[model samples]
Target chain A: MTAEDKILPKPLVSVRGLRKFYPAGRRFPWLRSKPPILALDGFDMDIFPGKIHALIGPNGAGKTTLLKILWNLIQPDEGLIESNHLADDDTVLVSGEERGFYYRLNGWANLVFFGRLSGNSRQETLSRATQLAERLRLSGILNRRYQTYSSGERQKLAILRALLQAPRLMMIDDLAKGLDPQATRELTDILLELARDGMSILLATHRLDLAAQMCDTITLIHRGKNIATGSPQKLSQQVFPHRHYRIVLSGDEVTARKILAGSITSDIEIKDGHLSAELVVSDEEELAKLSLTLAQNGISIIELSSLEEELETVYNHLLQDSDSNDG
Target chain B: MAAFFIRDLQIWVSYRLSLFLDIVGLVGTALAFFLLGLAFEGYIPPMLEQYGGYFPFVIIGIAFFGFQSNGLYGLSGSLREEQLQGTLEPMLSSRITPLSLSLATNTFSFLRTLVRAVLFLVLGALVFSVDLSSMNIPSAIVVLALSLPPFLALGMLSGAFTLAFKRGDPVRLVYGGLSVLLSGLYFPYQLLPQPLQWLAHAFPLTHALSGLRAALLNGASFSEVSTQIIWLLGMGVVLLPLGIVALKLGHRKARRDGSYAQY
Candidate 1:
């Protein structure tokens, strides 16, 4: 990268070396003295403009803390955060739980309240709230108390409040947890629309399928650190190289085993009168040769599918790699 | 800051009627005591000479204390409830400073308190015919108004303590205990023992009550109550800064511990 390129205003949010800690013995009231839980330790990432980035990790992976830091809700202990772009423009950030809405107030009042908090005048908030209500398809129930709204409806309202400010950068944290399929789809569509209109979004979610479908890039975090950042397919291939391919064959078990065993270079397991094997094929030629060899052995191939969507596999692989290195 | 305050005032206005009812309950309770004072008006002239001058003083005292107590309680309660719902951090993330935010949050409750004080005084005057047009009335009002900052400062200091300590009930435990026994709410300060009298005098409320009684009931002139006015002013000056400093320090400590939003 050139000096001009480095100095260019490109990324909307840049973070480095973030740290947070809490007293570990806090949960045990009886323990008067103990070390604290290091909730976030040296988290680092940069989110660029106009790109939909997905942050994926396990339960204690510091996703929430990262989002909180990025939104300036909580400052990191030791790090640099550069968000000059958002400083100049209205940015919408929403947590998985609807945090900003008032339960006692009706939906419109809560929206307006938050709208005004974001520096909008009362008239502006009221007008923009109506528009947001219509956009979120919540116009009919705007006057109802927020507590009366269904969980999904409340989440949608929260999302609408976030968008009501006409944000340039939107941060969503683990938003796909409790939503049904239809709500998830609707949310995805709305997110796609926002991204298409040149709004940069950073979404933290555990659902790999959603990330795979929506995010243009993926940043995987494990234990408060970024383990991988690249395209979804690239990360998947890098993490799990020899895709776990399931082969179904209809033939004499002994013959099939003999034919498969001859070509396989690694492990093999037989179950339910079927043969499952892990083969090491380095190139297209080897794959073709193995298939041809099976065909010649009179083994009718019933199915051939690769296991790629199992997120646990990818997570465990990354975690094991980090654990081994630490050990 | 003022804008944030007004916004909070608007939210309070939305619930104005319910809040008014709560204030009414407070005033009604205070008026109950004033009625008790009226019961002995015939046989207790000597006692009345010393304390009868404090009837209106009692009325204002209860009304103002209720306003202060409930205002702080409601503001802190609302904040804690928001923390439960996960709104505290987000609201804090906004540009408004916590002082300004607090002022805004407590605006309605304070206004409600002021309005209730007026209503209670009117009801006390009509039923008991207590004279408040004495020369001391202005000084008493000034004392009450001046004492507001220190009182609010104490509330803010307690709020900060709550934020930092996470589970200390010092605000309620201390304020409730003192308000009942030492705030001069139910009786005059001289009725208590010498040590207790000194303890009561230490509080801002005591100075306010003394100044108000001297002005409204005893018909004392402003010059006559110069010492009490100085005491009230000194309390405001000393405690307000201390409270602000404590609040700022508590905020920093909580943030450093990564527990500022725990509530």
Candidate 2:
């Protein structure tokens, strides 16, 4: 067992046999009798305290639905959701929609209103909102009307509103949707700091790289069902059995290509200027054999490293597997 | 609730032009009534004679209608706006109870309508030469106070429809139209047919307006308008619980269907 798994805490929120179905085609008068679309089917997951849990999935995979149910914004058709700290003042959901704020009001006003609604005194709410706006680097735009702010600014304001209450459990859907790279990095650092301070977060996103970087555990769902749940490394190993390597050559580009060409032992791709090539071997022994082959052909390996299994690759593979199984 | 009021006030203030135009519209409405009253100066109905002229009767009608409209439509309109703006889900997720949310959402509109109604009355008495000497202020206050709950209940019912269904509330539309047409907003209910008058009595607005007119025009005391007040209170007794139940049921249905945030 890994050291990371040894000290895992008990789940703060436990959801079991969660199911939701939405009636389909009510908008079409001719298709009124269609069966409902099953959005969540026996979905089960546990969100531990003080950990960043990522709910990663494709579109229509029930991530948003689950978040909505957790936030008490929607009712599940059937489920048992037991949470230790689901109180209104301690739990918040930062939805992806940018329309949550009152456009006619400025960001500061909206934040103060949201903070007060979360059960803070007016003076305290204002102080906390100001502090949060400064932390998010949004103080400059805090007095501007919500409609006048850019999408990124609006997103930051939304996050600031949620953070004003210092919620214990925050369910964020697509948190980095409209943020620029710098803002995304800043928000990510802030989230990590919050988690370290014992705040539990359940983040739903299609940004697999971010999930892999920050999530302590990831629950991958497909078609309303959980396909896998584990540490990034464990899930990647399970999904990707082959060993992949990227080798940068110091010799002539054509020479490296000739050495790798028609190689039945591995799949190789010559990259830019043929100086670099990626090789996928079925096993560690096969990788060693390929490196030896390149050397025997006068190809000097300047740099060689095993490619870590990426969250995106694991996600795609699992999804394809599910698709084939359904088919 | 105070947060909701402050937030709504801030938003309303930001739309300065709309606020300015609202007062202009109220003035324009009073002006139309003034011209109409001048044209029918000598043709006052016998029922309106105690009021001294058609102007007082029409001004009171306009004022009461403004209040009634706010009661019947304010909450539903607020709910619709929140849903369209995608703020309803977050608001619902707050610690506030559904009943409190409903009341808070309508607070600003209610206060605004109250101010407009007072302005209408003041402008009528000052600029249009409507009389104020014989007005029974205490009884009129009682009538207005008694009229609130039933109309608020009706507003909640309409809000329930908006919550359950994203489209317009049919109950609000039909009730608002019938109240305007048959509740003596412009003329006395006696002008309607006997069957229509019976239909009008079913509405709390009919009793409310009858009581308000008696108090404000005929200088009627509490005892004189007790029957109308009793009827209005009875409507409140029945409709308040009904409306609360409907709103709860609609909230449940919306959550079930995942339609609470739908525009």
Best by lDDT: 2
- List the per-model TM-score of the A chain: 0.75, 0.78
Residue pairs in collision within model 1: A24-A36, A24-A37, B136-B215
Candidate with top DockQ is 2
Query: How many times do residue backbones clash in model 2?
Result: 0
For model 1, residues A1-327, the per-residue Cα lDDT tens digits are 899688645777888887877655455677675776666777777777777989888888888778766666555778787775476335666777755576767887776667676778778988887887777788999888877887678778878887877877888887766888998887888888889988889898988888888888888887777888777766777786654456766667777677666455455566776666655454457667767877888777667665554555666687788778767
Per-model B-chain TM-score: 0.83, 0.96
Q: Per-residue lDDT tens digits of candidate 1, residues B136-158?
A: 55766776777777677777777
Expressed as tens digits, the lDDT of each residue in A1-327 for candidate 2 is 788578766679999999999977466667566789999999999899999999999999999999988887788999899988567667788876778989988887888888788788889988888777777788898878889987677777777888887788988998788778887888789889889999999999988889999999999998998888988977887897766677777666566667666433344445564466666677778767777877887777778787787789889998999899989
Off by over 4 Å in 2: A1-6, A25-32, A245-304
Candidate 2 residue B230 Cα shift, in angstroms, is: 0.2
